[model samples]
Target: MDPTHSTLLHRLLDATTWRAFDVDAEGRILAGHDASGSVQLVELRPDGARVPLTALPGAVSGRYVPGSRRVVVSHDAGGNERAQLSLLDPDAVTAPLGEDELTPLVRDPDHIHGLVEVLPTGEVVYTTNRRNGVDFDLVVHRLADGTETVLYDGGGMVGGATVSHEGTRALMTRPGRPALSSQVLLLVGDTTTELTDAGEHARYGGLEWLPGGETAIVTSDSGRDHLGVAALDVATGHLTWLVTDDAHDVTARLSPDGRRLLVVTDDDGASRLAIHDADGTFLRDVALPAELRAGVADFLTLPRWSPDGTGLAITWTDPATPADVLLVDAERGRAGVVASSREPLADLDLVDPTSHGVPTPDGETVPCFVYAPPEPSGSSVVIVHGGPEGQSVRSFSAVVQALVGDGHTVLVPNVRGSVGYGKRWYSLDDVERRLDSVADLAALHTHLPRLGLDPARSALWGGSYGGYMVLAGLAFQPQLWAAGVDIVGISSLVTFLENTSPYRRAHREREYGSLERDREFLERASPLNRIGDVRAPLFVIHGANDPRVPLSEAEQVAAAVRANGVEVEMVVYDDEGHGLAKRANRLDAYPRAVAFLGRALA
Candidate 1:
């Protein structure tokens, strides 16, 4: 590995990727590009020209207003995730847009106003916890009159709302009592009706209303372990299974014309796309490029359908390639790059991962993607994904590539409690069973030899919940790992639940176990509690203003481990939260961490 972290990691970080979010009527694509150091909204013109929509320190996402010429942009402060909604008129902005060009629609730094959908009637449906700071209420804001109305105050965190085509009604989601599940609600003329059965705790999302609004298409795990697309009747609340995969989860979206359905299957971690009729009749599959997965910048959601419905603008990428939006011809059944986010990194050899399933001691299989370097580096890094419910898929990761390029093998594991496999797999390590997922780390190390990696020379790396896994791995199974890098991870579950934002406490308690009822278990499961057991060198990275895990989580863990006479390096970014958003900070931070890894592993 290069002695200087800047040389190797600098070039790797320099390679940027653009993601297409929404396409306007004139074929101008609204995308998030990192060419300007931070991810900002850009308008990709038809004639190869580009217009910058926002210049901010944090990343921004926008969607074209259904019936208006303006776009609705969602921006946040420092990565606090307290989203503020604004309207941006492309014509009104200069070549490089300033903050003043955006007209604030919902501005409250203290509260979160997340963008849900923009109705054709020039109204925006969003969810905000401003009502009480504990429960999020669905709100409708009219751009014309600047009138705001509380759509639904469900007494809990209202997950998301999808407005109807005519804009008279909306479908909302409320987090269910069970983890990885949600309750669907239909709101029409001030009346909200429950759609899914309350008894059955199943995950429901990607709700799209049919032409007449009688039947809606949704992706759910209602009666099955795997997520599948189903036709939901609003009146009767009966669901007719449209497409189901025995192994992997699948999501579907209704095409604009309402004649075809675009079904995307999560085959392992990669994606496969297929077209189906409205009735679930199988149509021809859209062949994607080898090794590439079909998705938008937002990995979970399906690609955006063109306004005419004759084509689709989809984002495609693999472990080796950056994301680029491709246009798929619905009739011709072919794909071509319409808006390219591919950078000038073709000269660099980006490593691709091969899928593998490691068997755990408890007869469960942990899905992982192994990225092996061309040359043997002796040491390996296991990157754990956050969400505990989030799955590590085969996608382009600069960090993974940089580490592999530096000659260290990287293993991304989707242990128990990760989505995309099935509901059963994600529920394996819930609440009292949380440590079972951490045990999967030792299981992964035990099976490392099968993949020609040494367990003794391994390290753990992750952020958020994954960060917790890293700390847990180093503390609980101290002998297995050589080093650990925890980014905004929870050191103590007890503190995490107590210090987390009020709006998120109850919702997160559903997965991590309640602070009131399970305080003892939370303390026992906390890595900070077991810091005395840790022997490996550690590197802690955190944002000072992080509202999720809180900076104290990082501080206490670092202080505890350092007091034990073990080497601990802590890096805190003052202007960030949860994760580093700016490329300048990333260039400094990631390289330093990698440099630390090199020394610790050596």
Candidate 2:
């Protein structure tokens, strides 16, 4: 690796990202940070002290049982994402929980469990696909006695489940076939009722049970372009819109007393957080520190409100800084850093990203973030995001920043089928329409020269689905790109759907189409079939243990492209699952990737 690029990776890897998962009754924040290389759980005390809670080897995230000292932590082996629930006692002064002390609540090898919630009764409510291995069902687990009860076993994907404070009722969202459209179901003593008939193109999520347990607060896109907060009556299945906006509004956090809500609005990719009464009366926007105001503040975990409801905990990140956990006072809206992994970014000169909208031939607009080097390097790289359903948000990215530092312009585009936009925009590239996203990529390449970038020297890069896009671009429009980089990306849609983790097969097939119904379409969409058309040097990266995309995706693509006399470089990490999680692995892999791209583009 080049010394400059190696130094860039070193700096980027040094800054650890922290994610605050939950807050305990005593106001201590449970956060996951990469201070030890692999992400581990740590407790952030109010007095600015950090306590290591878990010393596990994989990514672990947990939440405290409302009134107990025990925390329920979820861990996945490698990155296969078949997460299992484990109980840990943070108060125990012993050197982290030993393997014998760690108690596994739901440990099924072939199944996956997630979205855990602790009911007031001390029963853990979580979603699992253990029944049929495809669709998820809600399960209530009694941690005290190791008893499990299937709460709701209905079909489709159980997006999430939330139990009421009294444990008498629960809410489960079943996302419809088209993807974003969903139906919210109310669960009462052995009976489930549909609370909202959110039809096609409408999305519903962020379910929270309000006081008295008769009503709940949820964010829905019914009868609107963007998601807005609304209250649903459990008895009547009626919705009363409270906070409607042009931008997507989501319920971030609710106070302990259930009197206040922290609503987060996704204005494109940047986040705007505001506090509101449970009845939807707007109070004021939560003022963020200057650093956090520049980029995205992730509210996915739901803000952790102090047990007393006087303070909230949040995670924030930007182009320059990795994620940091902060504690904010509820009354004055003042925020102070609780835990930050900022050592890695101490003195690095980082580039600030400028947002742009590129127009496609079909009259659709794709959003992109451009990070340019100080000195114009005619060469450019287009980094496609994974999740034909995922959007390119304003988050810190080490690879993008490093590429820009290496004198290459980086363009991260949120193409047609990305979220953060409305439901219609999100479904634009589903299944048969996926190639339309490839066209959007071509259009972005055409528009790059306008930003003083060289169209002839541009490279296409992405991971997972984005990796598929890189291969597709190289094959479909061979003349357009100078090189390509695919990280744990799909080479064949049919093979990917067939070989992906069984638990995720149904959900993924919903997005990419199934082999039984859309075999021909899947074949036509796969880049493997068109590999002969690729002319540029290709670099492939994959984790041997990846359960999502699988290593074969990279191996097959590299072998096929190499057979066509294309210069192909392959790197596979034996211990990694999906993506590189350990800092050492990242430091080893990323610089080589930069070196490969640097040599190819040069």
Candidate 1 overall Cα lDDT vs. reference? 0.83
Displacement of the residue 132 alpha carbon in candidate 2, Å: 3.1
Worst ten in a row by lDDT for model 2:
93-102
**Residue clash pairs of candidate 1:** none
Candidate of highest lDDT: 1
* Decoy 2 TM-score against native: 0.96
**Per-model TM-score versus the true fold:** 0.96, 0.96
Clashing pairs in 2: 14-344, 15-344
* Decoy 1 TM-score against native: 0.96
Stretches of candidate 1 off by over 4 Å are 1-6, 289-302
- Please state the error at residue 579 of candidate 2 in Å: 1.7
Tens-digit lDDT track of model 2 for 1-602: 46877787778866788998887767789998887888888888868777887877777888888778888888877777778888888878367653346777778866788856876577998888878887788988887788887878877668877888867678988876665578889888789888766455677888888888888888887778777888888899778988887756454567878988887788768877778888888887778776554766676656788777888888888777688887877777677777765555767778877889999988889988888899967889999988877878888888988888888999998898898878778888888898998999899999987999888889988988899999999988999998998988999998998888776677788788889999999999999999999999998889988988988889899999999999998989887887787788888877877888888777
Flag regions of model 2 displaced more than 4 Å: 247-251
